[model samples]
Target: MSQSPEKKPRLDDPCINLNLEMNRKAHYTDSFENPSLIVRRGFPINITTTAPIDGVKLVYIAGTKHPQRDSQRLFGWKLETKSSETNNYQLTPPSNCAVGRWTIKFTIDAKEVEMQATILFNPFCKDDQVYMECPEEQEEYILSDTGLVFIANSWRIKPQGCGWVFGQFESRVLECCLALLERSPLTPTSKSSATLVSRSMTALVNAQDDNGVIEGDWSGDYSGGTDPSEWTGSVDILLQYLETEKPVKYGQCWVFSGVLVTVLRALGIPCRSVTNIRSAHDTENNLVIDIFHDRHGNRLESDDSVWNFHLWNEMWTKRPDLPDGCDGWQALDATPQEMSDGCFQAGPASLNAIKSGAVYLPYDARFIFAEVNADRVYWREDSDGNYRIKKIDKKHVGRMVVTKAIGCNDVDDITDQYKHKEGSEEERYQTRLAVTFGTEPDIYENVEDEDEVKMKFHCEEDYIIIGQPIEYTVKLILKDMERATALFNATASVYGYNGKFICNVQSHKCELLLPEQKVFKGRIESSEYESVVRSGSIIKISVMYDLKEATDMGFLEEEIPLRAPPPKVEILSQEPYIVGVPIQLKFSFKNRFSSALTGGYFRLDAPGFSSRDRLEIDQKLLEPGIECSYRVEYKPRKKGKINLVVSFNSDQHKGLHTYKHINVQNSKSDDF
Candidate 1:
């Protein structure tokens, strides 16, 4: 009898077993072990087969639907024989492969077996577009999941670093990120390009355009959804979206940015949240923020206003679509501030282009340029009801642009990276260049300086913390030696961060003779505005001067941000906490207000140590001058330095958060 034909290898044969865990550590994706194998592009991942088989050809297909040949490739494996019956194959995805789930078909003779894997952007690979040359940046932007989001107005209060848990490597986050891309209108070809993906993500992060992720609610009423301030991380929001296939109820600028950073980082593209203090929302794209006021110096409702601070995201990638040298950090906003191409998306605009004032480039560069360098033009309604420019503020729009520093929680001021020094020659030149391409190129033409009397405001304290009296001084200086009498009015109002008027706190009016220099002091007690210090609200003190000697009036305003003191956190567990070991933490806060604080609650969030849901403890009331404390237990799941954030909120106080860094040692040894 002829030799029996060799048995054909079957798809379900026990001879072949894929090693899903192989090369995951090298790809920096060992943290994700779920639905399928996770690997980054431009890196070699080993797939082992139990039984060695000859004539095996592997074909890789990228994406799930309508897979194209451009993204598909065939590779003949060298087949490293691990043992007598086992073989390991190393497969390297193309550097430009589309990111998402990929199918790998193993062709043995005429038979085929298919396996699945997920591919991500490779910032570590040189050939990849998102490649980051610096090793430290790759660690901080791509690897470090916990970061700080700087809060507070830079001019009024010092920008404080608020701990934000990115949770990029959390369970189902990678899946959710891929699912988000699939939900968008991006094709497989567009998904392959980092620039396109980032641009698309800007719209996908908010539900305004595509029913994407977070539903933005700036209405101050968060009855049906969670308050934006209560959110400590993005994992819960994303998982909820993945589960419900609906937008998460409410998010502001920071929330949108936090979630975008998580999605970008989860896709293996380096990203960080950026805070632009005194950021402008230029609705007209005229390179000017117009503030119309009555002849008496009261702020009138207008179309354009400058936010106390605005938060957006910066993603690192090469912009091949633009000219050369635009290959670094690109600004992208998902806050739905304005529309781009009929969609609520902002950038992927190159920071290099932005710094150079090349606003003529693509993807909402004019809007972003105006955000950082727009001139604030004060327009006063004259007796004839026509608005005329009284004062032009060129340096107040973008005071300090900042982000979380590398390897630490401290703030890294990248203001210089975004623009030159304020009032500098280069800054002025760039501003002019930007205005040339703006909607109103002649906006600065014939703008006469009508201010004969100059006024300035200064805060007495280094920081005007909440629950303390605010003391500030207003000074008037005659630009020239001319005797003049002027009527001065100073009004203080509680304004939302978005420039919405909340409630007026105090107002003062007086007539004074303009000496060479005149100074006036004002005070507003904590009791006057303590109840109105909602999340991100600031005290705007506007001073209007009616000069008897001149035809034009003077308007000067200062935004005073009241800083909320962080709550205290104490780790009850002993030092040298180990992985998988239970650790107790105690959170406490003293009610500094004179009145009782009702609806008080404590929110605890620790990325690696706790579950996706934040631990919330309810307290009906916190007596004045009394310290309230809550204790909870958590088990360390992984070994590393993790940030534990504790936030305290009540009907009386909002936006009080604190964080503690805890070192979790490996259970195998003392090494962290």
Candidate 2:
């Protein structure tokens, strides 16, 4: 028993003892939640603790989804007092600290206390009262990847899939951007960041021509017959612009806004897209969007139009050259709708100043202001040929302006951030004050008798499945006791999520006599639209009725839902694939259709796979009664259950998918 020397303990043994010290647990005398405010750079941030704790070190970490590389030491400091606990610590972040959501951690004794906060690039050090009045997510939303967005001219805000915003930056995109930089007159020699922004905007839209980069084509028919969804990512669009200096065919306001967001983000500027519902375009600089109607009360299109939804961008920056109140969150519109300073670009207009009715600020502030705060006037000529207002809608111009929430996929109601609540005393006051401050006196003086045309409008269905007819009924319930004539115009228009119109599937126009209640019915047959339209199309229904004494108008819009495309092939694979071993796949398909399909291809995508592009078929055409099979192999790079997706598409058939889950086990053998 006294015996042999005890075997030396293994280094990996859990019971092996060594020099170590136990850390103390963090215990606070008082508890409090983190503040919901932005931490300005180059400013001292003060944090207070319940107990007086000394020997404490504070570390600030940047927020990132990746846990491994998440902790970035922005600022570090130690307590200076001799007491066991230091009640307060003031930490100052460097001037170049990143502007984003950040976490602050305190190593008290050996334990840790953590809190979350936001960092902003406000150089002027605006007071908390001002920043708080703006909006919480204004800075965060613009800086983060996720954006709360509005689409299809709808007021409801929802999360939109913007994966393209974060797509891998291609070399060609960078090259094109760099080429623009070379051609730009802006350099370090320029003092204002606005100059760099202006130059970048000029290069992005090629500011010389209104249709330089993306042709503002509402008629659609884009380049390569590509739809807005097919445009893929910003890199693809930018490269297309560089390779061929022609305007990409289809770009609406949202497309222009999206592209501008991508370019601004790429250029290291914090930007976000904001949608103004019932946005007005006052072409006359009259501070109002004019609506003209014929003597019969039929609505007529005018130079000044109101887009159901208009999108523009807001960039975070300090404007040193502008007036006192004009700084932070400058608006920029690259849609090329109007000219600014002899160019088609608009804004870098200050949102702060925009709020206070500083329409006198430079860079088309008057036009931008009119978008959200313009008057909507319906005018008609009397028998005497003098134009008079049929009705006036002040609250309809800007409603429910929204943005994306920070760190979440939800809508951020920034309507208050843009303007006051509709019809509120403050709203009326701001409107009147703004007009008095800058707008002409005659714009608001022409208020006339309200046209008492009361109508209730709705759609039977909100969405439509692709390759199907769109059936909807517009019911008009006239509350006024008057005989009226209703003019109905309904069109099934295919558009991108960015509001780029692809084509008009079908258009219908009819005249109806309005009684107490009348149902205006319409249908878009599948056969009529199957070839011309795809998913993401909208049925825009407009009804204009003129009463003998007065006239009014009504409108309704419906979104079409697209069903998943039919499967083109069947995939055969075995379960439990061996890691480091090849898994063979067989895709069997038959083409029995009358037409031949050229550009027939199959694509396989999965995690840890090295496939770059879709595999091309040896023979392009698949004639009628042709049976074809494709064989491919993939070796699992990791061991686990992997979702492998196989897709097949042709010039005729698009977006066919087949997916399977395959269990992969690690292998001991190097070669198999």
Candidate 3:
């Protein structure tokens, strides 16, 4: 008997289906866990070639976070191949591939799809744990005695790269050796632990597997003992330098040393393949020096070979760590060591590296670069196993497995490479910037205070680069100049994001600088005058400047701190107990002095005051007279009155409550 039709299921079930955010992430897969030294998978990558070639190395390329535009740390290729066929997933790198943390990238064409994996031997970070924004300006660079990092360029700033690309360009790499002196010149930080860095250097030298070698030749290698100092000469020796300090742009060209650096990075080592392609004929080296202004020549205007010949990078291996605390690989490898010490101990021929006779020519070949002769060094140990870097010769040097693609000369194909992108010329007309005013929403900010206005204007990121020195003449107007003058001595800053040419204006009505290069002398100023009063400022003002990179949103931003913790509670009344009697509860409260509270929340919880059937329920806010009242009515099912408690929470206030004890009574009993 189908008992009168069973109730139909409700179509609307309240189940929340999650919509997760999928991203293109880079990671290394671990094969082992417990002992944690195994790697299992690596994302396959291929060059942007159509009919992929044979023996061409392709490595993971990560973007940089440097505000200067080029956000690249891991520059150059990641893998090397000499095979004469199509490169694919079938092509596996050596098992002992270089170790350490790296963001693995996936590429099929110009666009990239990314993923990530953590190898115990070289574990990848689990989260955006790489916090801490890097310095936005050269001035922000700090030489701290922190635990691991020594001299850091971008300190204290943590750039959050929200999308798939990591924010490392805005992150700091610790220089352990330099950090040694930070702890009062005695206690060293992780980066400064000379012993640990030296130990890793030993590991790197020892980890030199014969299979890792990719044979190649150095053009300047000698049969017997050779002198790198004699070949490259001391960088200190400036024979012909137009500029004594700033670097002279070298044009497109590739030497054998540049090839070596690229090969190393492919094998999972951090290396640079610099192209010091000279544009002018120096007649000294019988070759042209790579000059920026010139197509392909060296200048006798300033006979400087160090600045002319090649660009170099500081590379780190899985085993042999660098003396400095250089993590993974970096393009921002600039350090006081290399900059001050002058050159690499290991000459190109003596580096014991795999060589590749290759040349990569970018349009701006002057800026393009790779490794150099002095970049490599060796670990020397005596009877006691103490290690020091001993110079090595060419024979022991490793090889760069030159891919057959080396035979191809596709270097001159013109491609539009611009700062904001091509055909986007129009996009350049409009500039984007992050204008900072208050650290947080200064809803209570006193615009009247010149210091506050000065702080707001000064707080702008790279203000001068965008507007500085009152180019053509705009002004940062103070809304009520007379009124603002009464409270604030306002100042402003114009930056170029690099902090260079960062000008600070101590005046409220200073001239504005041109915001862009097109009109270096174009007039600019504070978009609007700041009002004397923040509450009534009809003017939502901004300082106009030329922005290097366009911002999606206009400047004049601020963040608000968490609202002050709110007020609290007090208890009032409850119902008397009985089976069928109506229950009542009351509470007492007054506005606590903190953030303004519009309303309050009351929580009514009962464990055993159950009514088989639904009981009547009522809750309401009472009007304010002398004492405000909260009233509620419910029927009691059992003998006793339940303990009713209330809590209040709001955006402006929190942590408030009180309790009302309801004593149930029998309606008919004489025990009133």
Candidate 4:
């Protein structure tokens, strides 16, 4: 508050700033109660001496959370240096402090300087507070020790502090941790944010590797590209899948736990990690009860959601004798999944193996979970001072929850909406459901049981048109196709380049007399890319269809499904299809109001597409509002279901696709 910009330097040029950056302050704060908060505001202490002081010393005194018997005196200590500045001096608290009135005394060239601060024994209030007011709750941030996360509070995502892993990247994790630690108090009794930040930074520097990487034991590889923005770091899913499929697999992901443990241990910060069972991601990643093993030679396996592979650390006071409220340890993690992107607190139930010592094992009974979770990390902090978590990370899905979220794959490029199906965890958090099974986000005119409504749409699964006219067919299917003559509507366009006209259809549908496929004989003209662009641009030929809720005048057990066999746009061309080369993509399609247009978005991910081995386009805007076909040059990795991402600004809506290859299966390959 002293002039927002800079702190006024009292006294002149004979000063210096010392101490460590991050990760360095923790070890120095162990013996002190509630370390003072470190701030970015630099404090310069200059004492001009007639004759340079031989051994100058500067002292800072602060109080602990409570004035206990051991720390009889306040956290008071003097840092001695040959020069006055102490050159950014750092300190580790004395193993023992005589608990009493605390004060600081400094001497420069024998010119004495003194300051004092007090520690209070507020028995009624246990949580840390600065000034006279305390925060309702502390923001959770993940910290790593021994390559694992010590999850204290929830990260901003997944609201309400649910554990989630965003990505497995060091830079992202460091940025998140630093942002939070910079807010903690430095001294136990002192409300000094600067103190905490400075010390934490120092601690970080000491633990970093020569390559500047901060991980202790975790691998350096990270999955997913940044721009495409698909980050899945959930541990439970992986463990669950391994457990179910390869029940004899060894080595649980302890490297993650080790990272968290290492960070806390580096600074004498007491912490523990809690772990539990996890649900599966999809049919692809099933939670199988396999033989889970660790580097330490420990192994276990069971078909349990409560004991799945997981790791979260807990923070505690450095001393075993310290009381409950004397600045307890905090938890954090690099695994967004374990932390549920910061869903729970750093208390007892994070993960156990990640703790400094074997702490979580002994404190296992004190775990709890959420009860009525609308969207919250359920944990119990009862009046009895006991803590527990239940329903450990539930992906309890029901009904038919469809999401507008698409998968980040080739077919659904970056432009499509993500289509989430029923029974998937993403069905709730990612996709768009027409009608929810559990809770309804909105009630859009709940029609009577016998009422009928019509939905229509136009779609196309496109390929190149060589030289001949490509005939395509579109259909609308129903459970009782024989009962209702499902109304169908569609339009087709045969336009040349820029503006050269061809033909257009405003509306059309299926009929027993009319042809199901359209013929475009001599519709395409051979020309260069530039010549094609020179002619007017091509237009889309669309077909629309709809069906009303079947009404046999009485009982129909289930609602009939209307299917629009996504229209095909194949280009009959003279140029042959390359086995492994990208050709200019020139295709078009139409849109209708179809239920399958779930999120109006999709992704097109072709493996052998880019020469640079990079994918950068997002293609999910193919919905009705944005009509027509798209033209772009793209290469295919292999033959399969060409997905098209159809969402706009829907970061979570990159479409999911199942690529189909001739005589081949798409296994979950390790991208890293």
Candidate 5:
């Protein structure tokens, strides 16, 4: 028998390979090494085959149910040969194409080849609905993964930055993100629209109505799950959810916002976390937060609440589903605060609509409008079992709106972007317009203030740090100098970050004769709130004044947030770090409190430099005024700019997180 020669591969062979490496770079997704080609729409993608073909067509199919040809979720495009190359061709997805993972099929010479790729909303393309003209904004909102979340009480303190690692490009994150879309209640056709997908995600991020990612728990009980404050990033939470196929145990507003940002950025949607200080939760949707108080000036339970600070996500997208000029940043909240359209989701509400008081627009615009512009009405119960409005604060809700600045770690005040200047004529006009569209259009129709006494609560210091006495002043201005006698009462209570009352710290009652202008100074000893401050609670002081001569009452309250001194972080290793080399870091903090500190621990997390599991160091007790130091060693795995985040938690304090940027160089050197 003679040995037969092996047949060479032919141009029309069944085995065909498509080259997408060049397309990845052009699409600006070369940084991510995904199994499928990740691309943004409206950009040309060059495809080269192993052999020349007679004919070619690309088919894209999204979702598994009721797929129709040329539909929004299912479409195909024919490619033209590029220049004179036989095996090279070019294809461009329309700017309005569906955004998600798509199954692509190439039919060449009557042979079908199957592959997968993910298409994202393109902000760089001028014709894309989600187009953002500013290049700086596109880089910050769409590409930046790590960011700062502002957490503070705007009433008495300035906003502070908390480092968050989104880790959108981490291994398996894109797969997990696509899985979330599959688990949503959206129909296959609805999933094709970016606005609908964002709306569905608000419900999918929390485990309230659906078995989604994070379960919200604000009861201060972490017996079975991790605490929300201890979470360093979204990578662990997402991976845990994918692995167990169950909702993670506990999370808060910031956690929900953080995870949603990761999912959106991974899917190529531009998103950022926003913090609204003194955010209102309007249950009745009348744009009024009604707080009830007893005759003794003690706060009673109510359906409405004003959180110390609330965090939500803002996604940049076009709003063809809405009116014109509503195509900028859209607010989307996933904290599961309230239900919308029979589910626990909120927004895709246009920020422009919110600012312009177009609360009648689609997709829960009124609810979001109230969140940033509601009026706080205090109702006091009288002897006849009737409630009377004691005071109304117009500037209480939405005191400050902020987010992370572009290309920096600074806080960007976006208050004007959401609403006009407070107390301005334009602001009042917009408020009136929004109120007219509310469910209770006549809420402020007959309400009037007839009382003559006015009360104002002021904090003596710019900010109150933990382990220090809190000092404040209450000034009462009596118009007409009527020489009135009044009963003054001050009560301080510890309130959680979720605006839930924990326990009363102290109370003081006094009888005073009001002068033309009277000022009362008060102090809350550090010992009174030391035990409760460890739970990350703020001190809410309620001041009540009853005027005997005028038979009227006045109430004033202020929330004081105690700032924690951050621990100093130092990189002991020299600069010019190379890949695969170990680096040393040192963290030190002093116990400034009068009492000893116990149950102290430090958590270190670096997305690319460290493992999926965070590094934790536990410590023993440290006496007062004692300085504690810790040293950690981390080795770089890749070369780039990496962020090293360190957080300290103890029985005396919690959530003291900070980050440092480390630039790692490549180990290999090339000669010029």
Candidate 6:
């Protein structure tokens, strides 16, 4: 009689909890496996459970927080089960899905389970339904305010602190952007984004103001300021101009493109930042950057120059005005170098136009093509000042153009997508086709030289601290016995990223015999020019020499003595902080230079810090030789090791950072 025990709980009953199967969780991995998994929008999301359920519903919520299912839910989806215990839901997240960490609540009858997932906007998605709505672009490019973008000095995308944090328009920023937008005659049409982006190309750069917005100084230094993060974000750039009606100081190609990304995204256009290494600015549209040198091996200045890296923006949209397949990923350059129409804007240069060699596209397709795929033509000058194409290098122009991966920290190489691989027959043909568009093909005979003057020009170190000296050693080996006297001249000028000339710092001119006198040197004491220089400024050194008094010249260009301002803030804190314990974080702001600092403000920004932790300096002016100290009392809200970053900005000094880390111990009494 007592053998009739209590019945076992049924699997489908609300009392029985549903948990994800261990094998399912272990095997179904995402490309990026942080606490939150990232899945491309328009792709299938599969979930395998250990228990069978009657029905399933998914509720998307912002961030990782999950309150009881209610109207606060972003969206809900009824999942379709592949089997009783497996959920192979082919759910495509719309582009409008918020870009950030999101929690998805899976409701299985009365029991519920939740997991963290991040939805990313993928521009390359080809699904007709997704593309028609273009949700990915709408969410990522237009709606999202902040994101990670890649910037580089060269092809290889190693994080040398080159990645930039980009913030688009918030409410205040949007207000200013709207006012600016009114000035431009842009209306919502099929080609509205392309048109607005074109206007932004020139409008973002203050060409009229010297050292303000964009510094195109080729003779001077290129440093806009201490750090790229000094502007804080795109909104800060707009507010500075809108409030003051004065052009903001400092901006490079990256800065210009970053601002363009903000403006375009704010206006409901899909956009992102792109960087091209060894990028060419084909001012003449000849598809060749011609450099002339005297008979000796010295480099001379030309109208066309190649930058270390070039930054531009790409907006995703449909091109009803253009032919088919040229609809997505149009390049928009905000850097005020080349002018499109009467303004300094560039594309909506269709990448498809780039691939297809469609030079007749609405925007500047040929210019964008040359930027990433142009062949460099090195011209040699003779004794009579006559020059011939010495050598053409097709392989060195574009190497590794990269952008931030859709949902991760890694870089995504879109080089091949922009142009065919170097040395490929298709690439050569495309180059010729792209160059010869709307013009008769000229036979480039004798472009390759049988004998070329080999020169080695390098510095002891590529980077030098501000207030230091930089030395460049040049060596030339003559291959022709007919070469006579060589006149070597090395000129150093400071310049901004906008390619504008600042000031000539140093110049050395001398005569040497060919083959006998091959070595020449030049030095620059950066400290002498420290007062006029900032970090990211360029010390452009050009060495040009003539051989046998022949006009055939050889040229070498090098940038030396990179400068950065001294740090303004210092941090000191004890590690292993305990949760619920008040921690004393001490820091100091000391002016390192002779001048006073005005309008100084510092902000404490991190996940672990409270919003009220930021503060401005009590005194508007920070006097030289004075050290200001501050002590902040902070308590750990969560138990973990966390990084805190404090950034300082002012009218005198633009960028400075103080960072600290603290590990908090979890305790029973530490519950918030």
Q: Among these predicted structures, which one has the highest lDDT? A: 1
TM-score of each: 0.92, 0.60, 0.18, 0.26, 0.91, 0.61
lDDT of 6 by residue, 1-672 (tens): 423223333434333322323322332222111333445454455655545543433433321222324333334333456665354443345443433334554444334555555444434345321242545445555544445444344343252233232334233454444445444433322112344434443454444422223433333222553245443345556656677755665665666776777766544456787878778887777877776665556557778877766778787766767888877678877777776666666777788889777777878888888888887777777657887777777876767777755544457778877888788888888888887772325635567444335678777775655556778888877776546677678888876543445678888889877677778877776445656664345677876665655435556666653534433333344545677777776656767555677877665543334222346777778886676655667776545434455556666555455345445677645532
Please identify which of the two predictions, 1 or 6, would achieve the higher lDDT against the true structure: 1
lDDT of 2 by residue, 1-672 (tens): 533223222322222111111100011100111213334444555555555433323333321322223243334322343333645555554444443445554443433455444443332334321132234443343233223334434554342322223221234443444344334444322312533454356435533463356766545344454444333235455667789866665666666776676555544456677777667787877777777776654556678766666778877665666877666677778877777666677887877777767777766777888888887877776778777776667866776676655554446677776677778787776677666644454556666654344444555544544445667666665566556666666666655433344567666677667674477666777656555443233444445554444445544445543332333433355555677778777765555444566787766655444223567677678885576667887776655444455555666654344455456677644232
Candidate 5 lDDT score relative to the true structure = 0.77
Instruction: Report the lDDT tens digits of candidate 1 across residue range 223-315.
Output: 888878877778888889999999999999998999999999999889999999999989888888988888767778888988889999899
> By the lDDT metric, which is better: model 3 or model 4?
4
Best-fitting candidate, measured by TM-score?
A: 1
After superposition on all C-alphas, the RMSD of every candidate to the true structure, in Å, is: 3.5, 14.2, 30.8, 22.6, 4.5, 12.5
Q: Any runs in candidate 5 off by more than 4 Å, and if so which?
A: 1-14, 54-76, 83-86, 107-111, 294-298, 382-384, 448-452, 516-519, 534-536, 577-581, 609-618, 636-642, 663-672
The C-alpha stretches of model 3 lying farther than 4 A from their native spots are: 1-221, 225-272, 279-303, 306-329, 332-672
After aligning candidate 1 to the native by TM-score, how far in Å is the CA of 250 from where it should be? Answer: 0.8
Per model, state how many residue pairs clash: 0, 9, 97, 230, 0, 49
Model 4, residue 191: C-alpha shift (Å):
11
lDDT of 3 by residue, 178-277 (tens): 1111211122122222222222221111112211111112222323422111111111111111123222122111211222222222212223322211
**Models ranked on lDDT:** 1, 5, 6, 2, 4, 3
Worst 10 residues of 3 by lDDT: 143-152
lDDT (10s digit) by residue, model 4, range 379-398: 23334644323112223211
**lDDT for each of the candidates?**
0.80, 0.54, 0.22, 0.26, 0.77, 0.57
Q: What is the per-residue lDDT of model 5 for residues 1-672, given as tens digits with 9 covering 90 to 100?
A: 834323332433344444567777787676564655788888876766655544333434444543535322324444567854557777677777767766555554445454556787787889877788898887787776667777766544558888787878777877788888877767755765778888888898999988999999998776698778777688888888999989998999998999999998887778999999888888887788989988766679888888888999999888888888998889999999888888899988999999999988878888888888888877778888887776677899999899988888888889898899999998988888998886667666445465566778888676677779998888887876568887888888888877788889888888778784377788888878876763346888888888887667777788888776677789999978777888999987777776788877777767664324434344478787888878888887656666677787776566677788777787546211
